[model samples]
Target: MPTPSVRRSRPAAVRDRRAAASRPARREPLSTKQVIGLILGGIAFLLPLVLDVPDLDDMGERMLAIFLLAIVLWVTEAIPLVATAVLVIGLEVLLVSNQALLPVPEDATAYSTFLGALANPVIILFLGGFLIADGAAKYHLDKNLAAVLIKPFTGSARTTVLGLMVITALLSMFMSNTATTATMFAVIIPILGALPSGKPRTGLALSIPVAANVGGIGTPVGTPPNAIALGALAERGYHISFASWMVMAVPLMLVILIGAWLLLIALFIPNGLGIELDMKASWATDRKAVTFYVIADCVILAWMTESLHGINANVVGFLAVVALLVTKVMGGEDLGRLSWPVLWLVAGGIALGDGVGATGLDAWILSLFNWGAMPALVVVIVMGALGLGMSNVISHSAASNLLIPLAMGLATGIDGLEPVTIAVVLALACSLGMSLPISTPPNAIAYATGEVTTADMTKVGIVVGVIGTVLLVLFMPSIWGALGLL
Candidate 1:
């Protein structure tokens, strides 16, 4: 008798998943940097016990201490972001709610005051975004979308470059800019590689990073910084809906992209190279993909028509997540695929926002600035400049985490300035960094292609960055004012 056929083993990804789930959770020992973070955190926690700020209540001082510790850990990332988030919860409960350290008031519950941030509406909004983005990826929707969009600009090098940038921007609005850049990088190289070495090749390569950076400004879920700003403002009762954000940011992005395109043409790339671009379409009527499309479209529509629909953005977001799960567009394993660290990072920021309000730190910090006489436009320019600089050095989300609180504080004394507007501008400005490969993931991705040099990036980056900043400074106040956001 023939031997029975042996069943094939599960794929590596599946095996890894089962192994991960079955293994007991391990507590990894801290590294040297993490130990340093702990030391710093301990000092921050103890300082309030030793010294006090004038006019700050006991609770305020303690909260500020935790805030300081969080700032250090977050900036350094000495520990995992989720670990920092868990630490934030634990510290707040121990310091803020424990009667042994401080009296618990009738209005505050440790469970209620601190843990609420974990379930914040903004977090749910991102949850929805994550699910939708995951579904898009699972179906290769972004790639298909790009293939169709790039067909039009196949003839002219400048238009081809612009078209590529446009597609990159659109994809970045929903997908992570990093993922978008990586995906498009593959498509761009084959087309440009055939051409002789020249400016058009360099120009095409440069457009991906520039466009990816600018594209993220178009939506709340487009980048972590946007979510951070939205979550912080929402905590303060300033609601910036999905539609409102897109209305303000999309126009700004378009103008900036136009300026960037012009700068690219003038500086590096020549026109009319006649590159023949042909991207094959893949999504026509695949059942699973079509289901995903319908669900995603409806969710986005509801989010945009929020005023008419009366459904909260968070609710809409959660609905999308549910729909994805119910349709099996994403599975339990897919949950592992999501960027949980980013979500945790945002949670840390929300907790910090909570701490800011509880400790009266926001008001106290505001007191330090004499912004009563500063023009709102100057405030925009200064804040935008600060954001641009900080983002180049750290994660844009970290930049937003540091800057949004200060922006909120500044908003109080500056007449005609809205906290929401400051939050929006700061988030947008964080995406304007492109001078160095270190500035953003997209820039680093482009640099990795070996097509563009650091000097090449810097020369073009400076011009584009300046153009973006000026456009933002010129347009932000007017747009916000017109929208009655100021």
Candidate 2:
């Protein structure tokens, strides 16, 4: 007969085997898109080096090669996004930086100029935001807040979805869009399971992602593209404070969120259906949870009052990071869990922008277009549209990374166009893309629930996207002008 310990060990081993068997296998073969990306990326990288272009210097040619390679790789994701980002940094250092293996230009930047991107002020700001967001999840504050705040909208299905979207947007303004969607869905899944499947289910499922996506536009730390834009603008000496970003974006975010809610209700939710969610709140009162709550509130307060206190948002963000770690509310595991990939991606964009400006690639690219002939508003509108369309097919951050530096370059040359306005418009437009499952992580989450079909997301996404983009392009610039935000 086996001993009790032996019997327990056998079951544990059996369970581990079962878990391994259930896991999905990685695909070793490249897809058609990736194959094309790899081939074209190589060709693009070499084209600048091989062909002589008018007035572009050797360093400019090298930077152009790096730029083209980035475009292909980012759009098709032949390599991981972060991989391409680091590649950009490495290429800049090797080809254009003062440490270049091949020398030509007297104005080559120091390698640290590229490496320093990893620690950009915006990156530091995002680090603090990530820590606070992760702490919220660990402490159950997000879910519990949802449970309590969702009570008034519980009686009717439409009202319930409105409440759900409102809370989702509120959370997304502070948390990452993906995290907000996941947190809301965790609470919503049980309710979804309870409901009869069909349009009502689809409507409820779609609401969370739409709200989360739009909510990300509400604050600077809400999404990666926002950080990319901020970093690029800061490099150009145009600074928008944390509170100022919210003031500029939250109004538009609310409009889009409400517009999406109405559209979802009109299209998917039946007129008479009602939804009931479990509203029991289980607030955590432990010492660690209490400490986290206090820290989060203080950090948020400091960010919001930057104009009053005269403290930089980056410093406030770092302060939060130090406070949480010093208090031991978050330890090594939490630090390790921060979105390092996203940070790297943002850093890569900053470095790419630095390289472009430093190498005069921006001037060469600007020479290709008669941007002076076009109306300043038209230029911004075109860039916004490009951002929206590209982000629909690729990663939003990638779209921003490719567009922001060029847009900033255009801003300098165009009369009556501010770099801040164009940059903000581009970032906001990227956030508006959610027409397909792959458009955003939040949309992907919704689609993965198996409730929202591609067709379902497309119809809603197109209408919402169009409405948001039109309003953003037609009205936002003038509004910002009137408010002196620019």
Candidate 3:
């Protein structure tokens, strides 16, 4: 009895119902936290226009507001971190670069001013690091390396814990900490499951993240925060060679790693000391893998001898990229798997720092601080403490990004405080906040295994973070002075 139109409408309605049934439900509206972030961001944008600080010019005031807003958003994570990064670039383009607003003479266009951050040499260094990591992963190089490093001491539980910690640390020095933790996580689950549920099982699990976090400090490419600090220092005409960084970082990491091992033994002593792990190196004879290893070693050798070769670290990274592709050790897909989001995040930080320098914001901020009166050691402790705290709450790279410019600003104000030293301290401190699962990727990865709880991590993290900071404070001055950095 229905007309053709009615029949068509009925079928369409039925199809719509079926489609809706298959799809997920509508998500809830903005959370209270997100709404609060929006409000704070709005306030931050508007505050500088009203109450102007003495040292801050109109543009400096506006940039400060934006920076504060960014800090709030980053800490709260109301939006994606990448989105906040984009917001930083966008806001700088509008608020700082706009001719009607606070335009600078150097900026030909707003886009050009901020866009160049994506191609920063430090960023390129990261690109090379990513390629190497991907290639290593694709070729099972990390696993093989881990197997070789951990194979020797699989006899006793205490020795096994040490071996796992050492292997995780060593692998993290070259690959992504998250990847290293995940790789080691699978290796240890069976061993952990074999043991009774108690402190020892928990301690072994906790060691992976602590070691990974500590180990990342050992290499520039080990983590994004390291690259951020290195790049910022380079921009200020201070450069630490790849080998030079390891010279300082490796010794510190070894000390902390051993301390962590002892703490685990003391706090969570294993009942059985006879658990054997099958750590025999696999893929021993793969020619392609060997080729990858050889190329990587060659690149590392060049990096370590940068004093003799005088090749820039980023250039070495590029060479590694070319060598890997030419040798067919890495394919196009492997390159595609690199952490583009993280790169974007770092690029945003670079852009923000560049803006700070270009716009005189750094000078204005430095003027407000009375650093001349403050002790240099106290300054280091404060910065280190702040870096450690911020990294625990937000992304480590984000924390580093926020602190490095401030540290540099402090360096300008504080007589006899080396900018490079402050930068190094800030970067190292960023890695020290491993007390919470959210502090770093490696921590989260281990926590995901359910063998370790948040309480377990928090307890270990607090001690490790505090001790690490204290040690850096004690040794960094002499170390940097020896390197002619102070």
Best-fitting candidate, scored by TM-score: 2
- lDDT against the true structure, each candidate: 0.80, 0.94, 0.83
Looking at model 1, residue 223 earns an lDDT score of 88
Compute each candidate's TM-score over C-alphas: 0.86, 0.95, 0.90
Tens digits of lDDT, candidate 2, 1-486 = 976664458889899999999999987899899999999999999999999978998999999999999999999999999999999999999999999999756767999999999999999999999999999999999999999899999878889899999999999999999999999999998889867799889999999999999999999999999999999999989889999999999999999999999999998887778766767988889899999999999999999999999999999999999999999999999999999999999999999999999989998998899999999999988998998899899999999999999998999999999999999999999999999999999999999999999999999999998889999998999999999999
Candidate 3, residue 256: the lDDT equals 93
Ranking by TM-score: 2, 3, 1
lDDT of 1 by residue, 287-382 (tens): 787898999999988988988978989899988888888888777888888888778778777777777776677787666666676898788888
The deviation in Å at residue 16 for candidate 3 is 14
Mark the 10 consecutive residues where model 2 has the least summed lDDT: 2-11
User: What is the lDDT for 227 in model 3?
Assistant: 88
Better of 1 and 3 by TM-score: 3
lDDT of 3 by residue, 1-486 (tens): 976664568889899999999999998788898889888877876787678677777777777877888887887777888888878888788777744355555642465767777788888888888888777777777777777887777777888899989999988888878888888887788889766787778888898999999989999989888988888888788888898888878988999999999998888865456777776666745778889888888887888899898999889998888888888878787778889888888888877787787667888776677767898888888899999988888889889878898788788777777887888889999999888989988888888878888988999999988998899987867876887645
What are the clashing pairs of model 1?
none
Q: What residue runs in model 2 are displaced by over 4 Å at the alpha carbon?
A: 1-27
